[model samples]
Structures are given as C-alpha cells and as structure tokens.
Target: MNTKVSRVYPRSLTFGDTTVELATMTAADAPALAEFVKTLPVHDRLFVRRDVSHPKVLDAWIGALAQGHVTSLVARDGATMVGCTAIVVDPLSWSSHVGELRVLVAPAWRGRGLGRALIQENFALALGLHLSKLTVQMTVDQRAAIAVFEELGFRAEAVLRDHVKDHDGQAHDLALLSHDVAEVQSRLRMFGVDDALQH
Candidate 1:
C-alpha cells in the first residue's frame, strides 16, 4: 500500500479523437490554469467551492498544491487545459480518512468521456492515499455528472437545500454523493480487478 510506489503521473489518454496529457498540478500551471478557469461558464463557476476566477483564490489553490493539502491533476490538450480534478483532504481533521473529490471539465469536453477518465484516476488516487471514503457534491441540475459518478459506484449521500448561490443571488440545491473506497477496494480485490485499476 505504498502510494509513492504505485501512482505515477504525466500520463496520456485519448477521449474520442482528442489526445490529452494528464499531469500533477504545479505552480508553473498557474497561467494556463487561470485562463482555463476563466473560460468556464457562469453556471459552472457557481458550483466551484471557491471563486477560482479570482487571481488570489486561484493562487491559494496553487499554494495548497505545494503544501500537499490538495492533490490535483490537470488535463491538457496541447497548451490548453481541458479538465482538472482535486482530491482535498485535511490530515489534521477528524475525517482525515475521507477525501472530497472535485472535478471540472471544459464545456467542449463534456460527454466525450474525459470526465469519466478523470474520475477513474481520482478513484485510484483515493485508494492510494488510503482514503476510506470519497465524496462529491454538485448542483442538482448537473444530472449528467451525477449519472457518471453513480455509474462509477457513487451513491447518494445527502442534499443541501439552497446550498449554493449564483451571481444574481439565486439559491441552488447541492446533491452529495459518496463512494465507499474500502468497500470498493475489497470488492475489486475479490473480483480480481486490482491489476486493471493500476493503469
């Protein structure tokens, strides 16, 4: 269960006809990552936990990456970032064994299987980190995302009514989904899918 020995980054994957490079996020990615976040639609921005559109907020995220509080993967098509993910954890907190998963894909990349790839990557990451549980929350309107997560074995956990606010101050409900990483790993081991998850 040595994560450092098992997980490797700076990999490549093909979604549809597009080839993308997935790498661990670094300070050098700030510029391109900033531009990518800016291109996200308002609706997409609404669900992000922080206002990543702001330079300071985005900078803080980069700092977190260096501090190891957040482990992220940035998916790039050439020089442009098409998708990204964050597995946030607080080792000092009571729920240290749990990680909150956040994923964002550009509008053009949706429905092309990039998100699924990212999710699967994060699943391996969570397992490597020894996380027993993983959770993801998104606006209720994101039915497609919910479906993808569910298909990957996440189940409904809870709903936070009027949890998020839009620019116009409208409220939106957030649906939280969780995956039991321990249970999944056990099942995968039982089914002999352990080797397949590594790649």
Candidate 2:
C-alpha cells in the first residue's frame, strides 16, 4: 500500500474539440485542486462533503492520499482542471469493502461525456484496490447527476429524508446509489474499457 506508487491510466480522451488528460491526484496537487473547486458554482458545490475551497480540507485530502485511504482522479484541459472524482474507502474493518464516490465537473463541461469518463476512471481504481462496492450520494434534485449514475448501472439503494440542510436550514432529501464492483467491471468490458480495467 505504498501511496507513492502511481496508478497507470488510459490515454487522454477526446470530447468534442477538447482533449482531457486523466491522472490520479497526488499530494502535490492539493493547492491547484482546491483552487479549482472554489471556482465551481454554488449549486455544484452543495453536494460536496469536503469543502475543497478550504485549505484545511485540501490538506486533509493530501494526507489521505498519502496514506492510501482515498484515490482521486482529475480531468484537465491543458493546465485547467475541469473535473475530478474521488473514491474513499471505508476504514472500519466491517465496512472495508465499501467505497464512496464523489464527482465534480465544471458547468461548461457538463453533458459532453467528461463525467462518464471520470466515473469510469474511478471504477478502474476501485477495482485495482479490490473494493467490492461503490456508493454515491447526492441531493434528490440533481436529476442530471442521477441520470448519469443510472446510465452506468448504479442502482438507487436508499433515500435519507431531509438528509441535508442548506445554509438557510432548508432540508433536502438525499439519494444513495451503489454499484457492485464485479458487475461494473463486466459492464466496462462491454464498453471497451477492458484494457484499462486490466491495469
């Protein structure tokens, strides 16, 4: 579990006219990733558990990455970070097989296939770590996000009523979605990600 050992990724993907470099996040990336998160719209930031806009949280993620507790990937268009995805593995022994996925994409990059690419990269990482389950949580109103997950075969697993309260204390329902790692791998193979998954 040497955190410094880099994970190999597939070549960059081309979406429309842009080419996005896909790579894992390292401790050195904290500052840039933090700045990138801060540029996101408030609505996009609402679903994030870690306030990447805060230095402390970014430092925490750096530490986590160094300890191999989390694996994250970033999509960069040239030098600008456009999207990111992270999978956090459960530390408790009882739930160690489970991991949670967090994804964020710039508003301008939405609906152009970047999100799916990010999720696919996360799936490869989860499989590399031998995790059994992956889960994603989001407010129920994020229909587009939900659709993307569903398209990847993730099923709605649970609903926490009034799970999140906004800045004004208004509550929102949260949806929990999960994907079995084995099933996801099979799906990826069908989609021609077999070579990537083999890594």
lDDT of 2 by residue, 1-199 (tens): 2223235763588997888998888776776787787778765655667556668888888888877888888888888888888888757568778888899998878889899988877777777776779999988999999999999879999999987776678877889999999676677679988565645
**Model 2, position 101: C-alpha lDDT score:** 89
TM-score of each: 0.93, 0.88
C-alpha RMSD values across all candidates: 1.8, 2.8
How would you encode candidate 1's per-residue C-alpha lDDT over 131-164 as one tens digit per residue? Answer: 8999999899989889999999999999999999
Strongest candidate by lDDT: 1
Stretches > 4 Å off in candidate 1? 1-5, 195-199
Q: Mark the 10 consecutive residues where model 2 has the least summed lDDT.
A: 1-10
What C-alpha lDDT do the candidate models reach, one value each? 0.88, 0.80
Residue pairs with colliding backbones in model 2 are none
Q: List candidate 2 segments past 4 Å from native.
A: 1-7, 186-196
Steric clash pairs (candidate 1): none
Kindly give the stretch of ten consecutive residues in candidate 1 with the minimal lDDT sum.
Answer: 1-10
